[model samples]
Target: MRSSDFCIAGGGIIGLTLALELHRRGAEVTVVERDIPLKQASQAAAGMLAVRDPDNPPELLPLSELSIDLYPAFLDRIERLSGQRVPFQTTVTYQSVGHSSLRPAINLPTGLIPGDDGLSRLEEHSLDPRQLAPALLTAVRNTSVVILDHTTIESAPPAGCLISTLGPWGAPPAAPRKGQMLAVSVPASFGLDYVVRTEHIYIVPRLQGPRAGQAVIGATVEDAGFSTHTEPASLARLRGLAAAFLPAVADETDFPIVDHWAGLRPYTPDNLPMLGEIEAADPGSTKRFVATGHYRNGILLAPATAHVMAELLTGEVPSVDLCRFAPGRFGKA
Candidate 1:
């Protein structure tokens, strides 16, 4: 029988990050994926570290704060271990406010926004997940981490502990929020460098490496169950939204539509990720744990999620309170 200190059931960013942390602590780790690593929402993420996004749940604030703080060190470790460069695409996010009663200011110091008409420029960060994925994969491969790609894990893997980072595959009391996103390559002088967000859509620009001049326009969140299919109509609507914000995207002659894709995000009823031990099944069963249902914040929450999970597995005190994200809260997750 194969033995490992941990056998994680998902090979996405969350699983891989947590596996790396565990292996760093001298644990034998094996990551099992149903298909391949970084093939799902991991690569599809816009890579926004939106710690100050007002739309986020209030319960997520503490974790988000810890995550954004850990981001620099996280990327640094990934690059150092993998021998790759994953630079931040942007350091500011401009959130547009419509003509209405003004909301509370975001409380972020800002200088001159390129076009600061009615946008709230916040101190945020963004990166290209496409770049992050390969670095993380390479880093894990360079370690003692054993990755079982194209492998389906049983309910309980033969390990001292089993962590279910398995996105929506077996999530409970949760549904897959399908998202459609498209990307376009603009000229270096595209006149836009920061991330942009409106009520319905977001635009993120890449500022470094071969990905520079690439802007990603995303994301239609639908209740479509596990549909990997991208709708042309939806893509057109997304393009229209982008054009409304930046008219340059409408002209395909100058800026070409490079890629389009669809993926599913695991979201719980409360919209909070399920983390921590599976206490409901057996009060004493620390052998099984879950860390899924991150929904739209998986990219933002990856490093923090791994940090806490590793602490939990190693019997160390968690950095943040996990009461609000307890798995099995909806009955035996």
Candidate 2:
């Protein structure tokens, strides 16, 4: 029966960021989570801040670009508020090309040359999700945000503006697309300075410090329907992919798979996030809003989503075109 100016369902990264934003604008906010906050997709992400990725839908480019530009300020604000250092870096992302795409005239790491293929370097960055999740939680707790973890919502709450950030398994057009990932320990001799990505896998090196010489290797997309089970076959597949590109990972006898996990990304038919208000469930009822269906970009797109959502909720005009993301576009699907 808790209430506030806004009630957010699904306390993942998107939900926590939205709460932080709305609370900054002087709104009392409550976040409800089915499990501990940041234990789902947000925790499982490799935290790549990428907009120019080939995998990104063209329609999502504008939103992605906007979010990338806001990262600096977002990190600065959160770090100051939370009093925790978020491991982040602005490094190049080397996209490995095979015989199918891009010219093969370029050389890659380990004296690996692409025959009729090459590598494309883009200005990209990454954050350590292990650090980010806790920092975000700290920032939210420092605010007036009320978090009701281990709670589930049967329907929209009876009061306040309800905003749903529930990832997959929540509403229609938003279903679970399971992804499996693993983290491996690399040796100090393993010289991987930038994020490396081929068609199948990505390797993001950890920032220097006590956790230096480690990288996260992932992931496999499966339509297993809300399942987070980790299979050895899938882990082996990811390991093979990692070793194929970064031979150093395999050559280093000490580089062993330290951890593995799976998470569900919220998938939508159009592959675009749903934002804006849900038309009143019944006449004269309080309106609801949604900011889910981000899929794999949830961590990358969080700050921007929170910004625009706060704008919309506070009656301030959002700068971006949200028409395409409206829930009515699905028409009760």
Candidate 3:
């Protein structure tokens, strides 16, 4: 039996980041991932570090702010360890109000700038998850971390306190959500330096050297189970939304199609992540813990989550109040 101090399931950003943190704190960690790190939602994400005043939930703001602040240092540490530069830009994001009566004018501060045309400023700032994920994985791997790919958690460990980071699982009946997304290649002339968001559309720029001139546009939330299938209907809906917000892309012939994909974002009734430890079956035992349910903020909250998890594992008091995100908060009432 493979043994380690900690075993993390789902190697995406959150799992990998936690692995790195655990390793940094001198704990041996084994990560079991179902697929490649960036191939899932972590790669498909537009990498927006948003905190729109309107969208910010009072309970989650503190955690969000803490994560945002730790990003710079996080990136620096990853780069130093992996020797790869992760691009992070403080661009202005805009939220264009459309004429559709379906929704009202909504503005929010995002960490990305809208490069497409005809979008008004709502908020902006940006980070490249594509670059960040690989950088982090590389750093962890360099430290002799073990990651088992294409492995699923058929069943939780029978003994150690099982901490479920599985986004869609809670208590008993699990409800997983699926999201769709697309990647398009744009010419160097696109000149879109900011991330743009409309009532239902968002566009982010590519940060890799090879795809530097392109942009990744997408993301449609659906209740289609945990399947990551990119259906034509969803792609059409996304393209239509993009064209409406950026009139310039209305001509399909002018824009080059690159890639299309989809992923699952774990959702819960409260939409807040689950964190903390589980008491061992033996009444006085304290052996297992969890830091999951981050949903979409998994990337943004990775650093803080790692820090908190490390504190828990080391018996050190965490610097922040975890009461709001306590895993037991959602226990059966």
Considering every candidate listed, which one attains the maximal TM-score?
2
Q: Which prediction has more favorable TM-score, 1 or 3?
A: 1
Top of the candidates by lDDT:
1
lDDT of 1 by residue, 205-252 (tens): 888877788888898999888888988899889988877767777888
Write down the lDDT of every candidate, Cα atoms only.
Answer: 0.84, 0.82, 0.67
lDDT, candidate 1, at 69: 86
- Give one digit per residue, the lDDT tens place, for model 3 in 33-139: 66665466676577788755234466777777777788788888898999998876536766554442324323433322233333455455677776777788889
Per-residue CA lDDT of model 2 for 1-333, tens digit only, reads 656899899899999999999988989898889889999899898889878888778888888888988888888878898998786743878776665556443345552333334778777889887788888999899888888888877543444788889989578989988889888887656566778777678888886544566788888989999789999999888888887766656654678877889999999988899998887759776668999999989989999999999999999998688998898898973
Candidate 3 wrongly placed segments (more than 4 Å) = 1-3, 34-39, 96-124, 150-163, 169-174, 279-281, 284-286
TM-scores, each model vs. reference: 0.91, 0.93, 0.82
Candidate 1, run of 10 with poorest lDDT: 108-117
Order the candidates by TM-score, highest first.
2, 1, 3
Model with the higher TM-score, candidate 1 or 2: 2
Where does model 2 exceed 4 Å of error? 97-116, 154-158
Candidate 2 TM-score, true structure as reference: 0.93
